[model samples]
Target: MDQIKARTIEIFLPTGDSKEVSQAIITNESIKIIYISKSEIENQKKRISKIQGCYILVGKDDDGSDLAYIGQTEDFFQRLNLHKKEKEFWDGVYVIQNSSDSFDQAHLNFLEKLMIQEAKKVKNYKLENVKDGNNFSISESKENECYLYFSTIKTLLKTLGFDLFVPNVEEFEINEENKFYFKEKNNNFSGEAIFENDKLIVLKNSIVSNEENVKDNYIQYLKFRNKLINEGVIQKNNENLIFIKDYPFNSPSVAAGVISLKSKNGWEVWKNIEGESLDKKYRQK
Candidate 1:
């Protein structure tokens, strides 16, 4: 019986004339499990002309509960039946019923990414392997043209510590009730993260800035900046700081904490030229 079942599993996914996909087979008398992605399910449904991708969440946890596995397959019924035949824990997936009749899986993919990213910030999930981000390859010039005009508004609101999670980034402008500033293509991405109730811009999102690391604190930087200005290694021209010498500091926090009791944008605080700050001058023209 086991040999026959293994043979069935082997013949499931077809090859493109010669490219075979692999599957995990359990030989032990105890238990074994295999996983498949939701994309695979979505693809299968389209090929067969049917709706797919829904879950029957049997339970929940204190923080976020689920004994069920998130999965995707082309033939939901066939896949579930196959799992029941092979897996020891048949209840998990076999019992689930499809609930998502109108969900756009492509959009759901975005939500899944956001959920995983935010979940890692929680204390219990601190060990999650999700990497810290907002890398340089993200082009600022393209931000205006590629997205729904107010698309990043929630991210801006989230940074400002406001409550704003509407999922769709496009609806904010069309709806007047959104109240937030709908600053279409016009924005100040590189200067001070000027906090306005209407326009919430990322301080680090500025093209002029070095894309701040995730864990940096705006308040802490302020305190650190104040301490540096007092110590004298870095002074100010007007609102910005000026460096009198080569500053050997790293992050804003570190540069703020160490540099001669007086730190500025170390980029601006350390320099060979009089009144020139490394922070601003170091950038290529």
Candidate 2:
């Protein structure tokens, strides 16, 4: 059977607000994901307290970087109550449970360990788990079942805007057709970017001009540039700033603006090897 088969998902918004308490399930699948905001815990306790499952606490750090804490428990409400008092950083939780209460302690342990390992591999969020959970023995058949459950968990988490298991840029295939370049000889500005998955990715090692060259009136972009530098996403090397890792920007214009240190219509400035503007190639149709 093909591994990538189309599947349907159903989401229920208990509070009418997508951000409050939401439940998601794949069609015909027993695994369920409940996203509960810190503020909604009081309202959801009666429904979720007795659930046995693995959960992830999601939040942001002081610098606004994403943070996550993965755990499993026999009673969801009880575990969350402890976190409410002890873990101040998390503002929401995603609980993964079986609809029929089919999972035992062994199953939860296995899933928790698997999730922590994958989250660490992605490095998309700062993990609060100091140690991966203990290994548990399970039947080979049950182990295979756990893998399938994990796959669904990953999908639901991403659907909720948490790309916890998404692959890093280095893992992406570099399609030459999707690649674009921005360069200006006089200012020592040069950058390589790729338009993929609806976002522009500025490849690592790309050179950027000094902040002084940025348009004075574009305060937002200037602050963004400063934040990237402060966060070590980009660093000064000799006479130029260089990206330490591939970074994704919402648009070609934003990527071009940051690279050139000036306001520019990214569509017009980003070009292919043959010097075709991104606008002409992608937006002209």
Candidate 3:
């Protein structure tokens, strides 16, 4: 296995406030990241207006789900100014550029397309752009450079507390010890989940109870379940609901609740192949 070397990242807060507009850069790297709020656009125009780069607009939908728009432009300030007046959903934007101003339109286009493709794969945000960017041809060397540039963008974005590009379930080695199961014979609900990074991921194609079987009015599981249905994360198949893709929940109980459609002690309900409860396998040790 190749060893991953540590790199230094420096974040500079222009307004002396962490929440305000900030710039980030990795040591000896040409790539730069600037996070600017919509409200701060006018103030930042003089600094970033002429930079040719790719940007991501981030905000929330009417349902409060995470929403985003990705694009590339030669004039950062002008493009964002247009977005400010035309698009009402984005609250903030992340501008990615090179310090040397070497990125051409073709580079930006390739980066925009790659970012959109990866964001769609992550499915973490609702994309505001209806269509993907044009797949323009680029040399193999430039394509590799764009991919490396995107890797830094993804890292810096997450460091800035924006995970629009982060995969919900990162690819890693899997084993029996990391897997858990939930089955309800009466309701025909059977789910397969894995506990990874302290998160419980309900795998795709897992069957869930279509009906809300809980009597507690305070439980918000039903609302979340409905949101998933509306988002097409889960859909009805015959008499039961099935996950359209792997979804991660903060805790095992929440994952169980969404699957069973009732309040459940996930630690007690989720079991391994040996019928060992999550509580016994993890908590007890």
Give each model a TM-score.
0.20, 0.81, 0.91
Cα lDDT of model 3 by residue, 1-285, tens digit: 333667889999998876669889988889999999999999998878888899999998899888899999999999999998999998899999999888987788889988888888888888887878986889898989998998899888988888888776668555676778999767768998888778888888898777765667525878888888877788998787899888889889988887877878999999999999989988899
- In the range 1-285, model 2's lDDT, one tens digit per residue, is 665698889989989998998888998889999999998988898878888999999998777778899999989999999999999999999989999889988789899999999987766677889999996688998899999899999888778776888765766788777678898767777889887777888988998767664446776576777877866678999988898778889888888877776788998988988899888987898
lDDT of 1 by residue, 51-162 (tens): 3432221222332312233343444556655554654322322111123343344433333344334433321111222343223333444343223212332332233222
Query: lDDT: which is higher, 2 or 3?
Result: 3
Using alpha carbons, what is the TM-score of model 1?
0.20
RMSD of 1: 21.9
Over 4 Å off, model 3: 1-4, 212-219
Candidate 2 ranges with C-alpha deviation above 4 Å: 1-4, 135-139, 168-173, 186-189, 208-245, 260-262
Return whichever of 1 and 3 wins on TM-score: 3
Q: Best candidate per lDDT, number?
A: 3
lDDT for 177 (candidate 3): 67
By lDDT, is 1 or 2 better?
Answer: 2
What's the CA error at residue 34 for candidate 3, in Å? 1.2
